[model samples]
Target: MTLLDRLNQDMKQAMKNKDKETLSVIRMVKASIQNESIKLGKDTLSEDEDLTILSREVKQRKDSLQEFKNAGREDLVEKTENELDILAQYLPKQLSDEELTSIIQETIKEVNATSMKDMGKVMGSVMPKVKGQADGTKIKQIVEQKLR
Candidate 1:
């Protein structure tokens, strides 16, 4: 089944189980997917686009969690963690640090990225390979560390 199909099934399950948090997050995800489809004037999004949207949503939650934590808001951090956990279920398995490093090295070589000036080239090449399987911020940090 497609990601959308799976998400639909999960949403039904969440409703049946009366899981408010899970249901809310699933509904938000569905709404976002629908918005993107509307933007493109399509009935459904491609799986790649869905993954991209899911990753972006998860990243946003992570950013919020960091902000809350920095402000010593433990309650908000706990809620964000739960939301993050729900969001993570839809993402692909994340890459390990060693694996990410190797991929970044290969991307640098592929792009002939010898300096920070070529960071964009390296990022463009690497993102496609790592999308849905790695965090963009972490990937950028790795690439910068390698370049420096």
Candidate 2:
């Protein structure tokens, strides 16, 4: 099933099971996707567009989790963590470090990146291939290490 379809199916299951937390997270994601489609004047999103929205939601959840931790709000942190878990279920599986490293190496070669100055070229070429699979921060760290 498509990601959107999976979200809808899961939302229905959550409702049937009376899993309020999961339901809420799925609803938030669906709303965000719809809003983005409207903004882009599209009837539906492509896979890349959907991945972008999902990543944005994940980022928001992570940011909120950190803020709650900083404020020493145990209750809020727990809730945010639960939401993050639910949202994360929809994301692509993360790339293993070895897999990520190989892709980085290949990208560097593909871009003919010999130094840090070509960081942008390597990153631009790599990101599209790994989007929704590798974390951006991890990719950058690997690229920097390789360039150094």
Candidate 3:
């Protein structure tokens, strides 16, 4: 099913089950998707566009979660964690560390990146391959470690 359709179905279920958290998250995501479409003057978004929006939402939550943790805001941290969980359901399965490492290694070789100076080249080459499947921060860490 399309992401929007899935979201709509889940929204209905959440309402039936009185799941405020899920319902809220779904509504927010739907709004984000709709806003993106309107911004781009499109009536519908492609699958890649949907993934991009979902990825952006997940990244925003991750950043918030980290900030909340650093600030020792346990309540916000917990809420962000729950929101991340909800967002994750719409994203593709994340790459395991081993898989991500292997992909980075291959990309590094492909780009003939020999040092940290080529970090951007390696990242540019690898990001699209992993896209929504892996966190950019994690990818950067692995790329740095591999290059070093």
User: What is every candidate's alpha-carbon RMSD to the true fold?
Assistant: 0.9, 1.3, 0.9
Q: What lDDT would each prediction earn against the true structure?
A: 0.92, 0.92, 0.94
Q: Count the backbone clashes (under 3 Å) in each candidate.
A: 0, 0, 0
Model 3's number of clashes is 0
Candidate 1 lDDT over residue span 1-148, tens digit each:
8778988999999999999999899899889899999999999788899998898899999999999999999999999999999999999999999999999999898878989888999999999999989988999999999998
Task: List runs of model 3 lying over 4 Å from the truth.
Answer: none
TM-score of 3: 0.97
Question: CA lDDT of 4 in candidate 2?
Answer: 92
Answer with 1 or 3, whichever has the higher lDDT. Answer: 3
lDDT: which candidate is best? 3
RMSD of 3: 0.9
Candidate 3 per-residue lDDT, tens place, 51-120, comes to 9999999999999999999999999999999999998888898999999999999999899999999999
Residues 56-96, candidate 2: write the lDDT tens digits: 89888888889999999999999999898888789999899
Model 3 lowest lDDT segment of ten: 85-94
